[model samples]
Target: MRTLHEAVLDGLPEDLAPAARSQGGGAAMTGPGTTQSAVSRGQQARAGRAGSVRFAAGRALPLFVRGRGSGGVRPAFTADALRALRARHGGAPVLVRGLSGAVLVLLDRQELRQFYEAGPATAPAPALGAVPSRAAVRAVIAEEARHLTAAATLDLVRARHAVARAARRIVLGGGGGGCDGEGGAGEEHPAGLFGRLRRRGAPEGHTPLGRSAAYAGRQGQVLRAMDAVPATLLRTLLLLAAHPAEQDAAAAEAAGSGPAEDLPRLEACVRECLRLYPAVPDLVRVTRTETEWRGVRHPAGTTVLLPAHFHQRDPEHVPAAHVFVPGRWKTPGADEDLRMAPFGHGPGRCPGDRIGLLITTALCAEVLRRRRITATRPVLDPPGPLPVALDPRGIRLTLTRR
Candidate 1:
């Protein structure tokens, strides 16, 4: 079990530790304090009635856990919870006690943007040294596509395994072959890779233990990419299969003479899929210093939760929020808009986003280029509002030669 103090300091930057401790025992402000009493009456009322204990215990905890679980339906549950909260609070930030500590949930887009722009509150930028070049990535995608094309029907389960192998090759290096017989049994196991690194001798005089740790870190990166890339690809395929017109348009673009990276229509489809079903549906940030939103003051060590799934699909802000419209991304400044966080925003954004996008887009293009895809399982009706959750495991695609 974690102590309250430890939970409060979980993600605090080292430099801010002293200041956080010095301020009011690091307890998050739930009501107007002596210093905060000077604020206007309206702010006080809003702060005082921000969130309810019943709401936190009855609704927030379960939905949050479920949202973090595997499978597609969990995110929908989370989005529903946020929608209810927004209805009650009417765009004000809600302060509820999370399992860790006090959490402030931001509902307004502008407030969310402010929080994202506050650099110190976000996690540090990720290291991108191991990411491969475009040509190397394209080669991996082409090889994977060949494996898919050879199959009679593209099962998501098998595709996920193949993507894992490709991710391992891309991240840790030296798997370089088709999905069936690439780097041998060693490529299938992290321990095998670690041993190979040890035999090759450490880089820059790193000890055996140091090399092992480094290998473990890279393995973690591969695992994350494996999860995210496959989910995004699976969802994108499902969307395309359901919307025939869009699929045909994407297929035409894929068959063009232009490079895969420059396919705007295909990329827009992928982005639209992400907007509907984000790989990381919920984003959490811990405040390292005192933060203010509107007139309320959130103490240092407060946990800030942003339900990206809810915000991106909110019908009020996003036109045709539940519908698939790839053209939305083609509009000027759409990519940079904080409203849609397919790969997140600010310093905490996923560093592997470009690589992830490349892999998914290339695979989608390859499949669309040669095969006409139809969704076979858990059928989607294009005219209706799409399901909030799509279980990737149950998704099946039948491919016919174009």
Candidate 2:
């Protein structure tokens, strides 16, 4: 457990760490010292000593486990708990400032408004490196949704077609294939889409989000284009998806640092980025040989399921821990995701990372350039990709028309 989490922490960039650390190496000043970090009496009451307690990189898990909540399962911390925690602590940011050492007071809510912000500690001039132009980022963003949505829809349509074809094969015992198979089921005696698919051996699996017509048309083209992209671009995309803050800093670094200067390797940052907004948080690790994590003894073949979303919010690894602050990824241990493996580490990290990153990076860049700035979209829970992982209270913006 210790080694796994440690590896996660080591690989992460400072942006992955959610909490602010001062130049003095102490916690960043939040509000006035009310100590509003996510640690709370209610949280402790919720999480009790049990066989399992999910802890973040630097956070301490509860001695007692709490009752299960939403998402068909218990959330590490419920939004109500966050609101309640804030209320108990005295307003939002003010209380959050207290979570570390002394209570902190940042610029006002309006001043601190923006989807992404750079702290004083974080701001440094970009190193001489190759940077994407403002126009290129814009083009990618303008077309990203079309491509991603289309890819998703096409996948589903193909799946549905595959199923229908399979049913035809069943009647003809592998006849010419399924375009005609549904006819045999008959307009009067329908076998249903699922039935047809089962006959074909799941050759065409569809994801739920692919319901729109527009989505279907664009997917194949984007995926094919993605196939031909260089490995470096793909790697850049995935790393950006998993670590937005790092992407921001990296872009700056790449431009000023040099054409091929020593930049932060993206692997560790990917783990942390997924920690914040995982594509698929369910990762299971089976010990081929016996291994011990965090001094806990385990025999071989231990199937350990890591839910990065839950662990990312744990106060241990991420300070402030609850805010949707991407800057959290910038801290040292902030980059770790031992218990928070989103793509599964080692050989099991996500494969479609290139596609995922391409979509995610394009989306973020668009927002930064187009949307008038402000604080993070008001989120009741910790950060995760909106709509995919956690549905947020639509990202409210105090925008100035650009």
Whole-model lDDT, model 2: 0.31
| lDDT of each candidate versus the true structure | 0.63, 0.31
Model 2 misplaced stretches (Cα beyond 4 Å): 1-141, 144-274, 290-299, 331-344, 373-389, 392-401
Candidate 1 residues 1-402, lDDT tens each? 221111010010001011121222112355565122222333521223223443344334444444332344432234444544554445567675555556677867968777667754655645443445556666677766777667657766567666765665665555443333655543434323333444555462367566556555655554454466665676788899999999999999888834525778888999998888787766778888887876777688877777777778777788988789999999999988888988787777776677677778888888898898854666787887777667566567888888
User: Using TM-score as the measure, which candidate wins?
Assistant: 1
* Best candidate, lDDT: 1
TM-score of each: 0.73, 0.33
Superposed on all Cα atoms, model 1 deviates from the true structure by an RMSD in Å of 10.0
lDDT of 2 at 137: 31
Candidate 1 residue spans exceeding 4 A from truth: 1-80, 98-100, 120-123, 127-131, 176-223, 258-261
How big is the positional error of residue 316 in model 2, measured in Å on the Cα after superposition? 2.9
TM-score of 2: 0.33
